[model samples]
Target: MKKLSFLFIIFILIHSSVSAIDRRTEQFSTEFGYLTLPLPYVIPGAGMGLGFLGGFNNVPFGST
Candidate 1:
């Protein structure tokens, strides 16, 4: 019970200290450019081609 009370006091003190800090900023910049392309359709096609090549190489009867 004593340990629990000590932990509760520590928690309250830490919580109060954290609440006292101020975090407000008013200066910022937003100038950026990026390029993105779809991959879900591209990756599966590439993976299938790679897997077919691997299977062909492993099995002598297989061909691509």
Candidate 2:
């Protein structure tokens, strides 16, 4: 069961790391970006939990 849970977590990380957006017309001149990743995991005793990992780049200095 522990091994299965670990594999599942690895799968989720691998799949989510891929970006599906097309950056053909997008310009990365400004330093404004945000990324929110889903945090899901299962423990032997703690069962399952869902959380999130997020961040903002140049949020204080970069203008919208």
Tell me the TM-score of each prediction against the true structure: 0.31, 0.44
* Residue 22, candidate 1: C-alpha displacement in angstroms: 5.7
Candidate 2 lDDT tens digits, 1-64 = 9999999999999888885867786475455789999999999998999999998875665445
Kindly report the root-mean-square deviation of model 2 from the true structure over all alpha carbons.
22.7
- Model 2 misplacement above 4 A: 1-28, 61-64
Q: State the lDDT of candidate 1 residue by residue for 1-64, as single tens digits.
A: 9999999999999999888556586344233334454434336555522222111222234444
Off by over 4 Å in 1: 20-64
Clashes of each: 0, 0
lDDT value, residue 29 of candidate 1:
29
> Which candidate number would show the highest TM-score if scored against the true structure?
2
Lowest lDDT 10-mer window, candidate 1?
A: 48-57
State the displacement of the C-alpha of residue 54, model 1, in Å, after optimal TM-score superposition.
Answer: 64
